[model samples]
Target: MNKLRLRVQILFTILTNGYVYGFLKGKIYQGPLKYTCVPGLNCYSCPGAAFSCPIGALQALLNREGFHVPFAVLGFFFLFGSLLGRFVCGWLCPFGLVQDLLHKIPLFRKLKRLPLHHILKFGKYAVLFFLVFIGSVFLFGGFAKIPAFCKYLCPSGTLFGALPLLTANPLLRSQTGGLFGWKLGILVLILFLSIIVYRPFCQYLCPLGAIYGLFNRFSLLQIHWDEDLCTSCAACENACPLSLTVQEISRSPECIRCGKCVKACPVSCLHFTAKSNGYSTKHQTCVPPGTNTV
Candidate 1:
């Protein structure tokens, strides 16, 4: 409801769904250089994508024969995850934006807050393990087959990435099998759940988001609070998409850098800050405060 929340949401909408605007006008930006990384999980197979998706690249590496762990891909993931954490999910991911919009439907019931929320958060790790470790390593005899993540589990790849590609390539569609059907089913189930719950992928799945969340507590970009200036109104906590209790610690791994808390703080008690080498430099607000201390 605050200016910061509005700005963050608007920025996210623009970045993720900008392709819709371009597509309507019959203009698509397709260049080889767009294959480069710009952070967040934008589907490379999306007809309008200018850059490659990190998860796609990772899966490709894992699926390649004699998989050696592509340093470039891993480096990109680490750089983006460490720098912004799940800020990407909150303000950049196209899929994340899709879930947010679906949650706006009036018929849906918001999830009951549960202890299982904390437990289910670990599901992404299991996905990463099964897809990356067991599926790629054990089943394929060391990544010699198709990307297990894309084939079996990745709803993003199934919905936004692969479906569009299959639609455009009839030859590709001819090759569809039980695996594709399985992934499609998973995608459909997740899509249905999105309308009923908020960010099912972000909360229960999405290994990339899970990885980035690990860095949210210590990322270069972070939310800062001064208890001295604090009012324990719990406004920030209520506003958080991840259901984080902001007063306790704004830097929790689950804290998506959405800036909702910053906007929700009536006294402006919450701020964005950059921390490095144990020194902190505060920025007045979260959405591009213009002071580049980092």
Candidate 2:
């Protein structure tokens, strides 16, 4: 909801998917940048995408014949997670921007805490484990070379990849069948859910979020909590779309560092900290919940 964050999201989305020629021609870009992975979840199948999808790259590496290690993909995840954690999810992911905009539509009564929030938070991890890691490696081997997550569940691929490509390329449209319809249903369901629940896809399905969340505690960027300046007010919790308890927010892997809680802290007790700041955050100003802008 922050203007600066919104601007950054739009900027990154355009940078990652800036191929006008590819979009016009309805073809995937096969340039040198295609080999490099962007920090957030942009589908490599998108016509305008100039960068590789991180999840797609990981599947390509692991879906190899033997027990070859995906060192490059693993190292890429490590560097990204260690540096920024879910800041990428908060500020860069294209799909995240879609959900954010949908959440602001005011169509339905917004549910601050999504249904079964505590237990459903593990869904992303389950997807990362089963669909990505196991499904790619073992499930559809020999006969088919499909990346299970992208093929079956990635709404980003459906919304960005299938729609544009299918609309533009007749050859691609002729090939669509029950599988495409299934993916379309998934995309529609997720989009509908986003109207009521903020970031339902990020909360329940994105493997990338699961990976980055693991490093939230050890990432270079962090939200520091000042116990001394605390008034035990629950304003931060109420403001947080994910409903993270501010008392242990820094430790929660689910925290996207969206800064809503940071801005909602009435007493300036919560602020961003970098490792370069000697592990201590400054007493930055915070807007009260009533006065905070959307």
Candidate 3:
């Protein structure tokens, strides 16, 4: 399942960002498809992107006149989050795929875990609430011409958009300034960190992943665990790419629904199920981490 999903994600990445000729020719695809919003963080300014990023579009709407709500974008988020939660992050995000591949590079200095891994997972929520939402509504709404998160913090934009454009277009070189330097620095840091950590950006900074994580507890698609069939061997925990333990396998907000835990289950005890279908597993065994059993 992981292999098939990874292949699908790579295909989606290629399909969404397939204008290789545009990258070579130093031109952004300014077509009708640009009006559409992709759920993941592929930059709209990327020369090869077939659609606008939802966050970028949301920021644009927020920065515009009349204080109108973006119903389409909001609905898209609601629908996708309620259904798949961070499954999109696991199976569709181009940036997530990049980080996953980077972490696969054979290194003895493998950073399988980080200090304060549990706490750092909340950083994405702070980024979503403060930078993407409040900053967009207030700073961009009032004083700023550029979206704060995208202009400053988005490594995806710097890696996929700015760098490529700068490399492809010599004419655009004169426009580079201090902001470009800062973004480049951020991109470099994230790229380096991602080599050591599993999805450092996704776990600690992605606003889109944060938004989807909110729906993880109640999303229609979920990982269900049958405790009766379990030995606490901790294989699932070991297989998990993220910082999840065997206990949090069912509904951890940090879970990207990558199916690593399910694949690692020895007894076929973990499986995907609809949230509406209640399992017969004992309540004591089913509660998330820190509430009941460790």
Best by TM-score: 2
Instruction: Write the residue-wise lDDT of candidate 3 on 64-145 in tens digits.
Output: 6657787878987999899888888988899999988888887647675578977887889888877877777676546654
Stretches of candidate 2 off by over 4 Å are 141-145, 276-278, 281-294
What root-mean-square deviation over C-alphas does model 3 reach? 5.4
Tens digits of per-residue lDDT, candidate 2, 122-211, equal 999999988898888887655455589998899999998999999999999999999999999999999999999999999988999999
lDDT score for candidate 3 against the true structure: 0.83
* 12 Cα displacement, candidate 2 (Å): 0.8
TM-score of each: 0.80, 0.92, 0.89
Task: Sort the candidates on TM-score, descending order.
Answer: 2, 3, 1
Worst 10 residues of 2 by lDDT: 277-286
Q: What would you estimate as the lDDT of candidate 1? A: 0.70
Clashing pairs in 2: none
Q: CA lDDT, every prediction? A: 0.70, 0.87, 0.83
TM-score for predicted model 2 compared with the true structure: 0.92
Model 3: clashing residue pairs? none
Q: Give candidate 3 regions above 4 Å deviation.
A: 140-142, 279-294
Maximum-lDDT candidate: 2
Q: Is candidate 1 or 2 superior in lDDT?
A: 2
